[model samples]
Target: MRYFSPSKAVILLLLTVCCYCTSFSQTEKKHDVIVKLNGDQLNGDVLEISDSTIRFTYTGEKLIYNIKKSEILKITFASGRVETFNAPPATAQTTPVTATGASTAERRNKVAVLPFTFVKDGQNAAQEVSDEIQNELYALLSKHSGVYTVVSPRATNVLLTKAGITKANMLNYSMAEICQVLGVEFIVDGMVTQNRTTQTSYGNTSYSDKTKKNDNSDDKKSSGSASTSSTSVQNYETTMDMKIYNDKSEIVYNQNRKAFWNTADAYKNTMEYLVKRCPLYKK
Candidate 1:
């Protein structure tokens, strides 16, 4: 081997150091992923993890972010390690109501029907009727197979009640909150209106005065008169307004339809029409 000069030795050392540094840097590179409760994934490095928050930085960014632990579903490390986090309990105060509600991962193809708002004679009807309509709608929806999974009206009502939600105050909360509480991908809200539009009265009168044969004698000559009978019929016009919302709290369907026939229970027909035409209805 030939001996190298001072300058050549210095250059060789520098090259070796540079190659080692590059290899070390390559080996040190790491990527950590954060999965949010809303099913959003973030590719970044977890700088620090605390009891309530996590310090993170984007894949190529230098700035750090503090994310709430409650919002994170899991953290996957580049070393093939996964750490999971529990979702916080849902509560009116603790649970956040965003436009998209909770995680969108498992909510697909599920539906919930809420108690309908019933109006009769231009005034609010009884709650029982509203519940009746809800149950009826639920039954109709349950009949269709391979369309979607429908939550029972009883379960939906119980969840709403446990959350202190009622038709009277349902508007106070956003649709996303209700969707999260119900754990469904879609929500069905509706209103039924019935009004008496007309009344018809009909009557008929008959009289018989005839000379009968010997058997009946002159009894018919006495002239017996038949009483008049009258009947009153009330006609009602029924209309139904239906609205469907997705987990994102966006209104996907809004329609109002009136029944072809004016009857007390015409709302049933209108509701059926709307459901058949709704976007969620597969066939």
Candidate 2:
């Protein structure tokens, strides 16, 4: 039989653990990663590259993610392959310098809120609501100083008119083209739907009461009552669906939210919620 000292046994155990850790680390590093310009790294295995886009399935996942070349900084592969990207210089300034020689304080993630499409019984009301929502979005986003740069409704309308894009044909154009024409890094487009409803209800109640007079006479009475009523009014239910796309035309956010209130409140509440929930809010 062989006997080993305690110190020797402990040394052997540590050596074994070191070797195991090295092996595990090598195994974990066997994948590719896409590093974005903003310093975000997406770990995955490169699946395909086509049309200035890289498509890949994230490590240990089946879902695929596609990234535009313009947005990527570099790509590192498991097999020790490395590729660095150099984005071309911008031809035009996204946010032009001001008279004071100070650049706009807004982040690079500029956005354009296009006119909303409305679904309502009255055409005038629908137009008014759409205009109201656009104005509300501009007001809310602009107040969040430095968080986002929202294009003014007037500027957006002018661009749309120049592009010959009316409410009826706005959907026909592609998101990428819209982004280009707007000179923005992102596009915010959505639809507003209004639903009106009338409801009626009825109720019945029965009770019995007994009274005693001072002369020791007792009186009892039973009564039953039933009532029915009807009400009719226009109750506006607003459903707003918003979509945000990047300069590459990739969908960054697509959310649907609903609110029941007057036109102004509906726009205010829904837009506030969506803006806060948006990933771009704090980015």
Candidate 3:
């Protein structure tokens, strides 16, 4: 065993004492919940505490948390006030805004279209299709009188990207947040699949005896002599779904349409067709 000199022993003791003090100090601190599910958060220390709740600051205001409703994920306390741990709830909490006449009138018959998402197949093609569909949908909505105002694609793009949603497989925004942000009565969101190729061939020419035995007395005529080459042109097909909601944010109508484009001039044919045929036009 190695023994330390007197000075070295004193230094070691001091270090041990300091570490013990640090551990003791950490165990005695407590922090109030700073942030809540809603947009509310505290900027200052918690001033009061109870078995089930704590009071924290607002804009020079103080608010109380109902321990039952307030999520307690993780908390470290100061002798009683400063906290520094995240308490993210496993689920979301919705706080509805009561409808006043002013609020009701302000949101009357509004609509917003979520930014279209493209399902990436390890290529940029999907994004292109997403943009193409979104633009066409916007153009269609632009001409309608029955439809409420559509949220700008730029804003939708920002929100969608912030959510880390890079694909159109689903809309990640919750109904509450979406309606809250856009103040809309309806939201139209869905995916877009670009051009597809389908081929059908009739009379695939072959040299089988059954196809060739047209019993010429002198010689057997091969099926290749009667073979015909046929080809069909494939076009872009699109399917669209639109959803309408009432003030309560309940979906009232879900409309779907599928349209086909002509092979010669139908790169974006499906989107144009939906704009013309969508019921939103008459409404």
Q: Which prediction has the highest lDDT against the true structure?
A: 1
TM per candidate comes to 0.59, 0.47, 0.43
Q: Of the candidates numbered 1 and 3, which has the greater TM-score value?
A: 1
Model 2 alpha-carbon miss at residue 85, Å: 54
Per-residue CA lDDT of candidate 3, range 19-45, in tens? 999999878634444555554644445
**CA RMSD, predictions in order:** 15.5, 23.0, 18.8
Clashes of each: 0, 0, 8
Flag regions of model 2 displaced more than 4 Å. Answer: 1-107, 121-126, 145-147, 199-233, 260-267
lDDT at 36, model 3: 50
Off by over 4 Å in 1: 1-103, 204-212, 215-224
The predicted structure with the larger TM-score, 1 or 2, is 1
What lDDT is obtained when candidate 3 is compared to the true structure?
A: 0.54
Instruction: Give the clashing pairs for model 3.
Output: 29-77, 29-78, 30-77, 30-78, 31-76, 31-77, 31-82, 31-83
- Candidate 2 vs. true structure, TM-score: 0.47
**In model 2, what is the error at residue 84, expressed in angstroms?**
56
lDDT by residue for model 1 (51-169), tens: 99999999989999999998999999988899998664455544233332446766788899999999999899988999999999998877873568999999888888777787776
